[model samples]
Target: MKKLLFGAAPLSSRAADVTWLLFRLHLGLSIAIGAGWSKLVNLTTATEAEKMVGGAGSPPDWFVQQVADLGFTLPSAYFWAVLAVWGEFAGGLLVALGLGTRLAAFQLAVQFLVIAFFWYDKPEPLLGMYYQQLLFWAFVLVTGVGGGRYSADYWIWKRATARLNPPAARAATLPAIPVAG
Candidate 1:
């Protein structure tokens, strides 16, 4: 389980690792703050607004209706709506922190792909689909490459391994010195 969580594939160079870091940061922040935060805030705040105007705050009614229109029907629609909203907000945060990079990236990739193919409509759907497709591919890249060396997963893995074999255990395995007779 630990290995599954922390065993990120090694990068060939420091530059590559840095690039992954930057990409993860931007992608995570964009989803978390730009897309999900307002909806999340509205859900939590329980505002009396009829619909989410200008993308500021989305009341339950509006969000549920949108999810239902997307083919999820009522009751189940509410569950799926909340799931997608949390997936964007919290999953983005986890990706940004590099705590669970692969899992979070995969989730985001699935969510974005769905949005790209299903969410947009006949009016200029091409543009919206193109934009979402880019995000989907970016997330797929992260899922393949993982969090890299500078990620939280690496730091935690390093600490855990160090604890498993302390200095005393290492010294015990060292070769003994021979004294001249």
Candidate 2:
């Protein structure tokens, strides 16, 4: 790999962590533009289903009818649509900020899964599909672990751990207690 890259050095864990953080930050910011920001700007009504989907070509009337025929609740449908859109927006924001990364990434991952698998006619077949797949995997990573050292999750974890477990130096400074027989 290094030979093919014109004497480039292998990336270290620190570099990888930085790269991961940057990758999520950039992707989250970009996704937010359309997925998050657009929906937010247009959001006025709590039950506005049409606003969830941007541009033209919302699901056909026949499809809606079919869903209804299958006993799909109208309010539930709208509620989910609005939820997904807001989730995308909120997820992107949280991921970018490295706050609530796991939850945000999980939500985004589910959103992409629905789009890539349910929405796409052929799953993982095209470059676009591959992009979504990669993004999904990346989100999964963030979900499973987190945004790494650069994230708020990391800071919170470190603080919590420090509070839970004192440093050796600090522990050594404490007076020894006599044990009760």
Candidate 3:
């Protein structure tokens, strides 16, 4: 069983690498534009947002109130919203490009935590937010594992290390030349 699970196998091909890259790109862009970007734009003019859930007539009736309950003060509400939105927007782009992916993922994970906590008062549809939470956890895992073989970071690190140590590259390329009599 162990051998079946951990047996030596050939690495994936370049095509597979490109496919994975495209998958990450699609995932990142969709999450950024569809989910994060709207939040960012809304944060710019969120005073009107207080009307969506309820007006200032009641304290615990609006979305902003929930945010306040989560420890965001009056002015800090805007700041926290902006931070959360930008973290998702910019971090999604970084994850898409596979640049600083781990850091980006970490930021996004924190944003998810904040959003989840703030929304504790009025929970959305389970199918809607559940997948987002799952995605955040996946991002956290990838943050620890890095962007893998399909990432720009991998290639950049390889090139940088190679440039810093030319002898290592040469040694890596050296072949076992057969001696002839």
Best by TM-score: 1
The residue-by-residue lDDT of candidate 2 on 1-181, one tens digit each, is 2111111121358888788778878978877755555555464445666765765323334434433443558866655555666677778988887777777888899877766656544565556677777777778876776666777766766666567678986889899999999
- Model 1: how far residue 46 lies from native, Å: 19
Q: What is the C-alpha RMSD of each candidate to the true structure, in Å?
A: 5.2, 11.1, 9.1
Clashing pairs in 1: none
> What root-mean-square deviation over C-alphas does model 2 reach?
11.1
TM-scores for every candidate against the unseen true structure: 0.77, 0.65, 0.65
Q: What would you estimate as the lDDT of candidate 1?
A: 0.80
Separately for all candidates shown, the number of backbone clashes (residues 3 or more apart, or on different chains) is 0, 0, 0
Model 1, which residues run further than 4 Å from truth?
43-60, 120-128, 167-181
Q: Give the winner by lDDT.
A: 1
Off by over 4 Å in 3: 1-16, 43-66, 122-128, 167-169, 172-181
Across residues 1-181, which tens digit of lDDT does each residue of candidate 3 receive?
Answer: 3221111221277776676677668767876765566454443343655444532122222444555667778677756655665666778887888777777777877777556534566656455478667776767765665655677677676666567779877888899789998
Q: Which stretches of candidate 2 lie over 4 Å from their true place?
A: 1-12, 43-73, 120-128, 168-170, 173-181
146: Cα error in model 1, Å: 1.4
Ordered list by TM-score, greatest first = 1, 3, 2
Give the Cα error of residue 5 in candidate 1, in Å: 1.9
